[model samples]
Target chain A: MFEERLKEVQDAVEAAMQAAIAAFPQSDLRDAMAYAAQGGKRLRAFLVLESARIHGLTDAQAMPAALAIEALHAYSLVHDDMPCMDNDDLRRGLPTVHRKWDEATAVLVGDALQTLAFELCAEPVLGDAAHRIELVKALAVGSGAAGMVYGQALDIAAETAATPLSLDDIIKLQAGKTGALISFAAQAGAILAGADRAPLAAYAKALGLAFQIADDILDVEGSEETAGKRLGKDADAGKATFVSHLGLAGAKARAAELVAEAVAALEPYGPGAEPLRDAARFVIARDK
Target chain B: MFEERLKEVQDAVEAAMQAAIAAFPQSDLRDAMAYAAQGGKRLRAFLVLESARIHGLTDAQAMPAALAIEALHAYSLVHDDMPCMDNDDLRRGLPTVHRKWDEATAVLVGDALQTLAFELCAEPVLGDAAHRIELVKALAVGSGAAGMVYGQALDIAAETAATPLSLDDIIKLQAGKTGALISFAAQAGAILAGADRAPLAAYAKALGLAFQIADDILDVEGSEETAGKRLGKDADAGKATFVSHLGLAGAKARAAELVAEAVAALEPYGPGAEPLRDAARFVIARDK
Candidate 1:
């Protein structure tokens, strides 16, 4: 059921992305913009949609919020792939935006994507003025300089410095770059559903950590062919990773532990949280 | 009065910039962050302060908004001067951030600046939730992909292709890149004043054009020595400019006309608006 809903959300996200590009005037900007945005897994969108489903919210009701999350995910990827940053040449089996165009185009396209995140969030569909305000705050903290930006800073610093990073340092970095948005996806869904803070925050934190651990495990086991980019670049760069810090078996065990913790946190929501539980399992189990 | 008030606002902004950087953990991030942010014209800061003054607000009440605007301007300059973008080697008579540090550090610093803008705007000193919301919205639109980002995309595109851009096309591009924030500064001041829409918007629009024309005139007549950076690089790069299209004398005349028009629009405020009028004169008549 979670897999089926994920596919539905992916389709909605693809359509919304196409609609957003249509809003811009055509130029090289449109080409770079479309290329930068096109190929994400829409994992964030699914998290938003699935969490909304747990609240008994229909797809139509959750689509705008999901689209906003997808836009932000796409934007992060665009900036992350720039030559000065992560510098990846491929994403999801396609050339990254900077690899396809000059760096200027990629930067501009990324900026456009970031604005689209806010613009979509500001649309009146999600909730009232206060809810929209909360949503904007969440998005800003999740993706902005203080959160993801700080994480990227630490990632770059970690590469050059002689000091060995603690497990906590690694967790802190990933939490900002990857965890913040993932948590936002879940919390935004709960916010839309008007759920109480206890259940909302628990799901957000646990699921965010689970998602990050799954990503680490994938970096260790996945092939470049499968990942559509470099694999184990983390180890190559001597940046600490879950697989290196913990052996491959230990990493897998940790992932499972994280998923269990994630699912346990959803117990308060009872049967309404089945999709979120499935998602936690899927994060650890995915091949890509 | 304007000179003293501008200095006070500048000092406040300088303090705010230092405080923001001090909050980060000590690292090279601190050095790159400080280097990128510490110097600039403070034009955007002055705009906010001057606009507030026109609305009968004190500098103490306006400093937070001014700092926020300056942070946005500084971040834009940092990103724009990056090797991937403008490849500029100099800014404010100092080495560009990317030139001083690695390109990666420069990129991270720009991201930090972008985040800091929102952080400053969110400060309690900016007043209540509604006003904070207005400031955030204005900053987002003025600097984000749809406005300045869109303009920048077009500007880059314009450089790589085309024989000429029409005056209207140039105005639209300038409006997005330069005028958007200037307009935001004017409008944000009015919002803080609890002023009505008609006067606030009228002032914003006029100030926006006046500032753009002044920038054009500066590019044409200001010496590289006095301007603290390369001059006539716009024509050198084969990019279209207001001066190139209007010719030197014609551009100057048009700029003066814009200043007059901007001051005329402020007539409704009478004595409350004299500094803004002086600012317009200062804009078009400055030697550097």
Candidate 2:
């Protein structure tokens, strides 16, 4: 049931993002941007659409927000994969933006994609000007220095730190690195509908933590073919991750607990949130 | 007179920017961002304030937009100085962000600064929701794929192209690359006041073009001490620039004519716009 809904929203977001890309003139920057944003799980978009549904917003009303989040995610990935960052040459089973084109292309494409996301977020299709402003402001806060960038800076510093990060430090880092945007995605519908946001925010906090633990688990157990990129990077980098700090069985148990917490957070919506609950479960169960 | 006003506004912008950077946690990313945004003429911010003054808006009412434009301009320069881009080591006679920190820090700093700009633009300090929305949309349009990034892309592509760009192509490129943000800055006051934008828009177009021509002239005749960065780079790269296409004398004459046009465009504001007129002339007359 969740797979069907997920695939539907995924395809819709892909098309919407393509149309957004089409608004630009024909150029390599446009083409490179489209390519980087083309393939993704669209998990963030799904969170946006599903939460919007629970808040009485139709798919059409919620889509630009959905697309904006996905585009923003794509921009992060494009930069994260650059040579000066993760140096990853592959993503989604294809050459990364830097490898496919060049570093200059990757840099400019990421920059342009980010601006495009804000442009889309400001569009009237999202709702009234107030709602759009809220999204724009929230997204900036989630993605900017105090949030994702701070996490990234911490992660980079951890790389050469004299001591490995403690479990608490790693948790805090993961919260910023991966959790902020997810929380924003889940709460977007609530923000837009002028509805209470506590339930969705709580659900996203638990789900984002679970999602990162799942990724850590995958790094240990999954193959490159299944992951569609490099695996075992945590071990290779000798960096402290959930798996290294918690052990294999311990990490799995923690992920399961977080997933349960995530599901319970949605009890307020009852049956209407079944898909989101399923999404939380899928977060841990999926190999990649 | 221009230098005194420039000094006053530049100091103000620096303080505003410093406060904005202070909001983020202390980290290398924050440090690098503050460093990159530290020293410049604050030309864009001045344009915003000067134009706002013409529209009967006080500096207090327009300060957020001024700081936001400077942040956006700083992000562009940070990225443009990266290894894959211009690979500069010096800016304003200090080390560039990448040289002072690292490539990842440079990239993330630029990204965060861009996000910070949008966040500031959305603030209530800018005006009502409608005004903020207009500012957000125009900034996105001016900085995104069709504007600054596109010009940067064209520049990178022109580097390896078999043919040199024509005089017209370069002008069109500059319009997007350098002109877009300046136009946005110049029209910001009118947008906030809900006044006619035609005069400011025309003034900005000519000013932006003249600014580029002056930079080209500086590349030919200015020194490192005067320019505060590398000089003769266009000639060193053997790339077509305004000076290359139009000849040094012709480029100077063209810039003078553009300054005249820019000054004439502001005739609508009469004596209230003399400072702006001085700014236009300063664009061509200054060594840097």
Candidate 3:
């Protein structure tokens, strides 16, 4: 079931990403943007489409939000890969934007993608005025300074700290960096589905944690071959991770727990929640 | 007349910035945010408010857009001051945010301010859904990769290149870096005032050029005591400028031409446009 759902989400992500690039006028920016977006896992984009499914939003209606989320994710990755930041040269077996072009082009591509995310969100297709406003707010809170920026700052600070971090410290960092944006994706879909704040918030929290745990696992044991990134870079950097805080077995258990919690959060939506449940299980079980 | 209009615009800016800060819950973020904001000439904020006045928007109705534009300006300055960017240690007679805090904090503060800009644009009090959407599009276009980011990238590139810049080169760079955002401010205010696209576009273009020429003048001759930034840095960096390309007297003459063009664009609106006329003249004439 999860495999089928993954395929479905992947298809949507490809379509949305392609459409976003197609919307732009041809320029040096166009190809760089396309390459930057081509190969992510589409986790945020998947969450958006899946959550929208739970709320009865058709793929047609959910496409724009899914594309917007993907654009933002791509933009963040482009910047994160810069020499001044994470400094990774490879993403998904492809050269990072900075390596492919130059630092300046990378920065501009990221900036364009970020702006495109908001521009796409403002399009007339996403329900009505109130819905679009809610979507924009959710994204800005999730991805902007208060959320992702804070997480990134914490990440940089954590690298140079004199003391080792407790597990809670690690969780807080991941929650802001990775979790916040994921939550935004789910919450945006929920808002489009017209879900009230309470259930949407709960779902967002659960999904965010589940996704982070999955990432932690990937960082620990996944191969550079399968993961398409250098494995164990976190340990090399002396950065805190779930595997560091929890023993390896404990980390796996925690991921299972998060998946269960995420699934439970979907009970309020009844049978309409299949994709979300499958997505939670997939998050924990994926090899990469 | 220009002095009276500048004072009114400045007053509106102070009120708007104060109200924006009021909406956030008090925290370390709030304190740091206030510190970053307290300094600056509020030129961008004034541009917004004055443009609105020129287009006949009431003080209360224009505050949101004004605050949003200021936030973008403040955030850009914060980032531009970082070590990897322009690396300035002083702005507006105070230690820059990066200098006062660590580079990490400065980065986060800038990120936060950028989000705050968008948040202000989306505020419910600003206008109806459509207007808010327009505001988001305008500001994003002005500040994002396609505009300011691209200009900044080009500026950085120009630093190392052997090519002597021509008139078109200087215009392209300035238009993206400074002119885009200035244009956005005018266009946003005009939108608020219910002006159609053609007139607003014309006003924005002239105002943007006029603002850049004034900046060039300040860089050349204004004292650090008066300008609040180290003067002559532009020449020192070998970065292209209107003063460099057009020569001092020629730049001043062109600035005056821009001011006249700006005022002429608003003639269709008659005396209701006096505020903008004053603003255009003031841009070239101010000490800082």
Q: List, in the given order, the native-contact fraction of each candidate.
A: 0.33, 0.88, 0.39
**TM-scores of the candidates in the order shown:** 0.92, 0.98, 0.90
- lDDT of all predictions, in order shown? 0.75, 0.91, 0.76
Task: Name the better of 1 and 3 by lDDT.
Answer: 3
How do all the candidates rank in terms of lDDT, highest first? 2, 3, 1
Which candidate should be chosen as best, given lDDT against the real structure?
Answer: 2
Give the DockQ (2 decimals) of all models: 0.44, 0.89, 0.42
Better candidate by DockQ, 1 or 3: 1
Q: Give the TM-score of candidate 3.
A: 0.90
lDDT tens readout by residue for model 3, B1-288: 766656676776776676676565444555667778774666677667766766666767878788888887887787777776777888888888867876656655766677777777777777677778778878887887567766776677677779767779878878888888888887887666556757767877988888888888888888898777778888888777888888999999998998888889887778877766777777888887
**Model 3 Cα shift for residue B222 (angstroms):** 2.7
- All candidates in order of TM-score, best leading: 2, 1, 3
List, residue by residue over A63-179, the lDDT tens digit for candidate 1: 777887887787778778887788898898888888888888877777677766766665556655456556766776777665777777788878887976888888898888788
Better of 2 and 3 by DockQ: 2
Q: Which stretches of candidate 2 lie over 4 Å from their true place?
A: none
- B12-46 per-residue lDDT for model 2 (tens digits): 89998999899998888988888988988888888
Please provide, for model 3 over A88-151, each residue's C-alpha lDDT reduced to its tens digit, 9 standing for 90 to 100.
9888888888788876567557767777788778777778767887787778878765677667
Model 1 / residue A80 / CA error / Å: 1.6
